[model samples]
Target: MEWLVLLLIGLVGGTIGSLVGLGGGIIVVPALLFFSTYTVILNDISPQVAVGTSLLVIVFTGLSSTLMYMKHKKVDYKSGFLFFIGSGPGGVVGAYVNSYLKVDSFSVYFGIFVILTSIILMFREKLKRKEKVNHFPFQRVYTDGEGTTYTYGFRPITAVIISFIVGFSSGLFGIGGGSLMVPAMILLFGFPAHVAVATSMFMIFLSSILSSVTHMTMGNIDWELALFLVPGAWVGGQMGAWLNTRLKSKTVIHLFRMVLIIVGFRLIYEGLAQ
Candidate 1:
């Protein structure tokens, strides 16, 4: 039963994470903490363990989604690699910080972060788009499947600084840096939504590698639970990538925002009550 729950969590996390470019750790980390605390099924799950395990699962989820996005030509490889330059080292730093958080404090902080992310999603569409800067050193022109061309660019140093913050959040919370990165790409960097999602997953894959290694050295991972979670996350990533091609995501986004709100409040309440 515990294994079954873990599988479902991975599947749901992967699908939503891939579809939205949030790196599925948002779902996995919370679910692990909730189940371990509120039920008899999963026992002895510390926040550190949950975060480490989630990051490991994100590695597979990001890989599976990235491969699918690559075939679709949605991923911007150059930008993804560039973002990784900052995110990799930032992730290591974040992982080290995670060791200092206690369960109640972790829950409260994570809840607040999740709620803020959902709010960002809510207001993102209404936000004024950034004007294109033609003189930036990292200019990109992307053509999607429908032949719609998008021109977006950012200074390499600016991008690196932003990505470092995103990676730090991912390492500290294990929620996949994409939650922050996707919005930054769209609002700050002028990336098309699909392109942002794809590239964010690519960055998540790379950053997760560094963060997970840090967690591994800290002995925070649960190998048995990760074994169950990873396969489901991998399959779900493929499913999500396929769905992103077919679905209109507005409705999905609306539903997901509600879920995030509920989960965020619950986590906050749990932390305060404890």
Candidate 2:
């Protein structure tokens, strides 16, 4: 019964995550903590174990979502590849640091971070882009499977720095980093919402793989919990990616904001209550 519940949670998390490029960790982590604490487990789960297992599940969710998005030609391979290069080293550093963290103390800090990010995302639509959107040295034109074209400008150095920060935080917190990357791509780099989502998922796939491997080596993961969630995550990932093709860019952003606000508040509450 517990396994079934976890599978259902994964399905919901993956579906929502893939639709907006959040990679399901935001949803999965809280669900894992809740279940392990009051209902699902015979013993309480440590926050580190819950976080570690969440990262493992993201491996499958990211892979499934990336492949599905790639099929639509929505993923910007060059950008994701570049970000992966920076994130790799950062991920290793984050994992090493996380090993020394205390779960209880880290949870409050993590909660505060999530809430702050949520506040930013809430007003993201209202934030004005500078007139110099085209000023970045590196720019690209990409066409999706539907033949819709998009052009965006970015500074390679800035992108690398941001990717490193995102990767480091993601590895430390057992997140996929798409939460940070998606907003940065759209708001800072002027990427189309769909392209940002697809590209972010691809980058997350690479980062999470590295992070998960590190967590495994540190013995942080709960294999049984991850096993229970993977199958559902796979199916939901495909389902959400398919839905993304049909959704409007504004709708996607709105959904993304809504999820962030809800999850952010929930995390904040959990952090304080615990």
Candidate 3:
């Protein structure tokens, strides 16, 4: 029964997360809550443990999903790497704080942020001005390790600020922060959807790695549970990438945020209800 529970949870959560770049937090957190509802082991930890452990699984989730984006050439190495500066350190600090911090203090903001981003993502076309960048936004020429040279329209300051905030959230909430990061890259920085998604996966990778490490430092991660979660996330992430390709961008974007708002409220309600 335990094995079955874990498997189903992984499949359901993994599929949704991979599909939407949700990082499986919506599923994992609630699933952990459910698991604890009837079980002794996982139930014993404070809410902090649950959030920390859920974050730990993302290490594998990012690894598995990022490959699909790379294969498609949707990744923008320059911006992705630049964004790393903020996510990496922020993740470490955030993870450390979560071990002893009260996430509830921040939950309201998290919900609000998610809700707002969802709204913007959904109504993206309404917000866009006619001025589109035909040229890259930065003056520097970047060459990827594979020797693909390109000019980007992205501003580093923007990436740094967003990455820092996103990273802080990643650590604090144990959410991947992609739900916030991906859309921002698209709507604010003018990254293509695929590029945004691909880049966000890698960014999630860095953030999750630091977060997991910090959680483990507190002896918080359940490796046994991660074993159940990671493999399934990989499969789901691929199918998600495929779906992202087929979906109507504007419609999906709008729907994505509405989903976030609903889910965010649902999560907050569930947490408070408990």
| Strongest candidate by TM-score | 1
Best by lDDT: 1
- Higher-TM-score candidate of 1 and 2: 1
For residues 1-274, write the lDDT of model 3, one tens digit per residue.
Answer: 6666666666665556655566766567656755675586454445566667778777666766777777766666767788889888888887777766554544454566557656655555554321354454553343444676543356678778889888877887777888778767766665655566777887887778888888788887777777776666667667666666567455555665566778678656654654
| Residue pairs clashing, model 2 | none
Total backbone clashes of candidate 3, pairs 3 or more residues apart or in separate chains: 6
Superposition TM-score, candidate 3 onto the true structure: 0.80
Q: Which ten-residue region of model 3 has the weakest summed lDDT?
A: 127-136
User: How does residue 32 of candidate 2 score in lDDT?
Assistant: 74
Backbone collision count in every prediction?
A: 0, 0, 6
lDDT of 2: 0.78
lDDT of 2 by residue, 142-234 (tens): 766667766787899899999998888778877777778888888788787777888888888898888888888988888888888999999
lDDT per prediction? 0.92, 0.78, 0.68
Stretches of candidate 2 off by over 4 Å are 40-42, 125-133, 144-148, 249-274
Model 3: residues with Cα > 4 Å off, grouped in runs: 38-42, 103-121, 124-131, 134-152, 249-263, 270-274
TM-scores, all candidates, are 0.97, 0.89, 0.80
